[model samples]
Target: MNLLIAFLLTVLLMSGVWLWQRRSGRADWVDAFWAGSIGALAVFYAVFGDGAVEKRVLVALVAGTWSFRLTRHLAVRLAGHEQEDGRYQAMREHWGERAQFWLFVFFMGQALIAWLFSLPAWVVANDPSPAMNVWVILGVVVWFVSLAGESLADRQLSAFRRDPANRGKVCQVGLWRYSRHPNYFFEWLHWFSYPLIAMGAPFQWLAWLGPVLMLLFLYRVTGIPYTEKQSLKSRGDAYREYQRTTSAFIPWPPKD
Candidate 1:
């Protein structure tokens, strides 16, 4: 029943956002709503679902913090945008006359992903364990590190972009110097927190899916591929050099 409610609520939220997207002709709002919806689900599960007070509160805070931060960041970045994201724009060109239908499908896809990603939070929130295990402690530490690292990456990129002189150049400062996509690495790393937080909880195996699937998406589907393509288009040899020297997803010392 709770699961059904979560799914229905997510669908309803996404449906409303889709209407807004249709009116504005910008699909980027899906990203903002994705983060917000996840946070909302965490709070809902924490407050209404079965769990020990401690675990429920912890899950809500941790997940809610991450979710709200991401949502606000995306919202600010996307404010007053009159066009869709480049990724979706490219899709629109490809789909042509069928673009509207396909875009609706895309919105639904994000809605589904939002629900799927909430699974770990759901598990962690319902752990019902009074004990503060070592795994939970480690999870909290990782969450803090990942959140800070992701924020640092965002700031570095934002600062680089703010400098008009750096136009058409790649960001290779701070965390960007080591990894081409430090933000993605930290985002993917964030997923591991749930399994650790729910270490002793039932269906801990399900929590593992967050990290695994997120890694796959970042590596293959939505993260590095499109961003690198855009960089290659704009920065050309500069980006290629960065790619040759920097790690793609992990934070490692640059090769050259």
Candidate 2:
């Protein structure tokens, strides 16, 4: 019943966004929606679920915090642009007249993916434990570290971008110096919190799905490949050099 409701709501939300994209032709809103939907589902689960008060509150706090940060960052990047994200723009070009139909499908898929990723949050929020425990504290700690690390990486990259003199140069400052995608690494690490948070809950093992799927997505699907392709195109030899010296996902000192 709850699953049905969440899916229906997600589909509805995506449908509305698709209509808006049709009218405005800006598909960048999808990223914000994806982030916002995950937050919404976490809050929904926290409020309506029969979980222990401690578990519910903690899950909501962690999920909601991540959602807020990610969506806000995407919103700012999306602001003042009628242009769709480059990936979506490429899809538009490829699909031609069929773009709208395929994009509708894409948007709907995003909603499902968002919900799927929230399974750990759902389990945590539905836990019946009466008091906070070590697992809960550990989850919170991991969430904090992941969020802080990702946030710092974003800020450093943003600051680098804001400097006109840095244009065409690859970012090697701060976290970027250590990993080619510190932001992605931290984002992947965020999933580990849920397994810890959902400890002892029914289907707690399901929590592993989030991190595994995210790593696959980041490594092969929607993440590093496309990003590196674009970076290579833009920064040319600089990004290649950075790629050579920096760890691809994990943070470590740059290779000499």
Worst 10 residues of 2 by lDDT: 80-89
Output the TM-score of candidate 2: 0.98
Model 1, span 133-196: residue lDDT tens: 7888999999999999999999999999999999998999999999999999999989899999
lDDT of 1 at 10: 92
Residue 216 C-alpha lDDT in model 2: 95
Per model, state how many residue pairs clash.
Answer: 0, 0
Question: What are the models' TM-scores?
Answer: 0.97, 0.98
Evaluated at residue 223, the lDDT of candidate 2 is 95
Would you list the clashing residue pairs of candidate 1? none
Off by more than 4 A, model 1: none
Q: Against the true structure, candidate 2 has what lDDT? A: 0.90
For 80-158, candidate 2 gives per-residue lDDT tens digits of 5667788988999999999999998899899899889888888888888866789878988999999999999999999
Best by lDDT: 2
lDDT, candidate 1, residue 98?
90
